[model samples]
Target: MSLTIHWTDHLTGIMRRAADPPRLLVACDFDGTLAPIVPTPAEAALLPGMEEVLRSLSTAPGVHLAFVSGRPLEDLKKRVPIAAAGFIGSHGLEMQGHVLDGVPGAAAAWRGRSPFIADAIRRRTEQLPGVFVEEKPLSVAVHYRHACSADAAAVQALLQDTVNGAREFRLQEGHMVTELLPAIGCDKGTALCALADRLGVPRSAVICCGDDLTDETMFTGLPNALSIHIGPGPTAAACRADSPADLLQLLQHVDAARRKNLRKGSCGS
Candidate 1:
């Protein structure tokens, strides 16, 4: 939708044209994108070398990095270990630019309300074996990974009932998890656009990466940018990476390419 994609070893070809002052915004999802998907949310950590890779990108001249995740902003900041990278959590609700938030998706405005919903969900599902409800400041993820099939199904039904209409909340599904998010229209896609706009970066300079359905919104959101899908699955992303290691390699390519471009510019000057 913004720019065409060409691939060889990585996005090197595209990076080259973004210029020495790339003004690129590199945004990625956390779990299953930068980190291996663990059995539990609390068990998730960055893949080896990811922190360094992200840090390298964060410090690159004219390049901005961000983590646009379903987890709350506070939780993401604790895990990412980078103070420079912008964080958009709660699936685009928290830390999103005011431009997007000012729109109908001002779900960021409803942050404090989710705690009450989370408490009610905990009360309802606590007795169900292996059902865990993870609460965010602005959202709630009900993980049924360890629950029996019947119990998971029942929980799904209950969540569906809770968000049946265009109510205050909506049901968002992920791997073995169902999240209760604000019904606001914003998502990873809108959030990415807002970030780019806020940073004054063009769409052609954007790089979006993620691993699951929720990430599809971003791929669809930045159709012209370089979007990479991790793991084996059908994806709207123009490229595919095998794992977080593969992602690290790709980021390294972009990093090195940008630095090289900067050196070339310096020499020419």
Candidate 2:
């Protein structure tokens, strides 16, 4: 969990997986992993050249790209806009490329409950300056990044209390926000795994990366895959990228590797 394994030291094997056999399912967390974390959700967007890198990799013959995020699916698309890329959004409650038709009816019903949850949180947090609420179709999030440290803790306590009182929802704490989503036995990892299975990618060829606690599901769920964690934190990922910029650099290399393999008409061993 201390993350002693740096991604730079394992470039060879990682690049090989990118260009080699079985086809690679590359999924990455959007905020703070693909794009730098911002003060507000509206301010978040991909960094320069990140879009091109992702597009290139997504179009590579042996590579498939997907964005796994806590944001809504439409918001993720609006932010990324990569044609070849697919999306798993709202912390895996809803996805673009793949549909979880088997998800429980009660879980699917949470979309209607989100408005009530968001309204409750907004009312409770209204007194705290800089505290705001974002309501997704299947989840509700209280963002306190702009609030004082004291207010952040208060927001967390309030969110935790709500989750404790509500059995159907679970609390998901991220960088500066707290979210509540239906406890439908689904998460980023499960969603990513489901997507990979649908795509026919083997466990060893799955490459997923992320930067938060929710992303930890992706890391632990695919231990055999090349899992990269962005930024400072104890993580279950196999390697670490110091920042989003570092992750972009890694993607650039991975894209190049895929291209090189395509040109040579052979896969890496």
Candidate 3:
């Protein structure tokens, strides 16, 4: 059974544990966690007041915030536009403003390969109505949200076959879209770990929030971190929030707790 949690009952404990570490890492998935899922990906935006809350949290002392998403690095930057926070894009394959170490030339190689792969998928699925290809720098997403049930299934099957026979790519299905990303040993979990390592924060000090199957990797990969799932489903997450509004409330509580701690420290000093 899925664990159902109340934010009011759990927020204080979560804040207490999160505040114990020297540094805290607050990372979240962008699309469904921060912004409501929309029919058109480009139309998705952060829920009202969330951008300000994130900005405040990002500026808080010893707290590092990041948005980890399947979107391309540039796209994520365009959407969030907070210079202080970090961004892990392309499902952890790309990091904004920095090159991933030990993956020398990976960016260039992926750039070179993406078009060909995207073109191939486009050619294969063009005849299917409502099937459109969204090409990113390091990945290609085949969105079939507008397709009929039969057409959607056919598109998925065809894409699966196309990717299965390929040597350097893999398929990731989410909602009504299927994405093809480079066959790399990285994902949201690894990305979160890398970010923590880069920031010198312990995994126990991190809190990851997400709302999809892709986010499950982060929840399972970081066993020490607090994981919160955004909607109803069986998940590895320890807590749950019913909607974006509920998530906003939880974040507001965290912000308040962190500020209170800071003020208390100041008064003691």
Please write out the lDDT profile of model 1 over residues 68-135, one tens digit for every residue.
88987788889999877788888887773323233234664665776788889889888899999887
lDDT of 3 by residue, 148-255 (tens): 999899988987787778767778878788888877777889888888888788888888999988998999999989888998888898888887878988887777
Candidate 3 versus the native: TM-score? Answer: 0.93
Put down candidate 2 lDDT per residue, 6-54, tens digits, no spaces. Answer: 8889999888877787477789999999889887889998988899888
Error of 3 at 158 (Å): 1.3
lDDT of each: 0.79, 0.84, 0.82
List all candidate RMSDs to the true structure: 3.9, 2.1, 2.4
Predicted structure with the largest TM-score when compared to the true one: 2
* Model 2: number of backbone collisions: 0
Higher-lDDT candidate of 1 and 3: 3
Candidate 3: residue 116 lDDT (0-100): 85
Relative to the true structure, candidate 1 reaches a TM of 0.88
lDDT score, candidate 2: 0.84
Q: Considering only N, C-alpha and C atoms within 3 Å, which residue pairs clash in candidate 3? A: none
